[model samples]
Target: MSRQSIVTAGVLDAALVLLFAAIGRLSHGETLAGLGVTAWPFLGGLIIGWLLLRAWRHPLSVVWTGLGIWIATVAGGLLLRLAGGQGVQLSFAIVTTIVLGIFLLGWRAIAALVRRTSRKRMPAPV
Candidate 1:
């Protein structure tokens, strides 16, 4: 992948993690002012995922990079939250897994589909 694609994937992953935190906080009647407190664990997990998977090399691979990152983001986030003395209920973990899986992997799936369709539309080489 190009440098730009790698950077974009990383940024988008972070943004999705933040969005997950923000939604959870808002649903609990928490203020946006506490967003950093809510987001940091999952963001940390996202970084860990990127590093562990060397995700930049295949940033858009839905099965490879995306699956590993999603797993890391959920598992690492829950572990970090536990370490930080934050609530880490089973239901919360389940929700986090489902949501982050959707957020991290969903985009890559869409992008893959788009690339496939666009390739089919391109004219044959001379």
Candidate 2:
């Protein structure tokens, strides 16, 4: 992938993680002022995921990159939160896994679908 595409994927992943934090905070009546506190663990996990997977090489691969990112973001985030004295309730972990799976992998799946459709529509070389 191009450098821009790699950067875009990283940024998008980070933004989605931040959005998840914001949504959770808002739902629980928490102030946005503490959003960084909520988001940092997951964001750190996201970075770890990307680096471990060398995701930039196949940034849009749902199975290869996205799956790893989802797993790492959840697992790593939980560990970090636990270490930081944050709540790690079973229910919260379940919700986090489900939500982050969708948030992190959903976009790549959609992108793959769109790319497949576009390729089908493109004229083949004679």
Candidate 3:
């Protein structure tokens, strides 16, 4: 809702993306350069997740945002594969995307819960 929230989400999303890519590369015995290719899906996930959250009005919107972004990333990778390319690594990419999405969205959810609890603890204006 606020600009700060949006910015925070973006930063978290990007960091998760990088983290996921690094882990993926390490797992596959590949170099960190794999991070470059992973960035596309990461960026896509970030944008999509942020936008969806921005428009979200329900308490569970964060969960939907995370799942949606994970789906989007996987779908993007699948499209790339279908387009006659070497394609992104399916296992690593999808797993990493899901994990990162959860982390990012989970952070938002926790923050929202904290804010809500705090508001409830405060006295209402007369």
lDDT of 1: 0.93
Tell me the whole-model lDDT of each prediction, alpha carbons only: 0.93, 0.95, 0.62
Residue range with the least summed lDDT across 10 consecutive positions in model 2: 1-10
Residue-wise C-alpha lDDT for candidate 3, range 10-118, written one tens digit per residue: 6666676677667767877998865777566556645664565553433235666656655655565445434635455667555755676676567767877988999
Candidate 1 residue spans exceeding 4 A from truth: none
lDDT of 1 by residue, 1-126 (tens): 799999999999999999999999999999999999989989998999999999988999999999999998888888999999998989999999999999999999999999999999999999
lDDT of 2 at 93: 95
| Better model by lDDT: candidate 1 vs candidate 2 | 2
Q: Report the lDDT of model 2 for residue 35.
A: 99
Work out how many backbone clashes candidate 1 has. Answer: 0
Report clashes for each candidate as comma-separated counts: 0, 0, 0
Q: For residues 67-86, could you state the per-residue lDDT of candidate 2 as single tens digits?
A: 99999999999999998899
Candidate 2 ranges with C-alpha deviation above 4 Å:
none
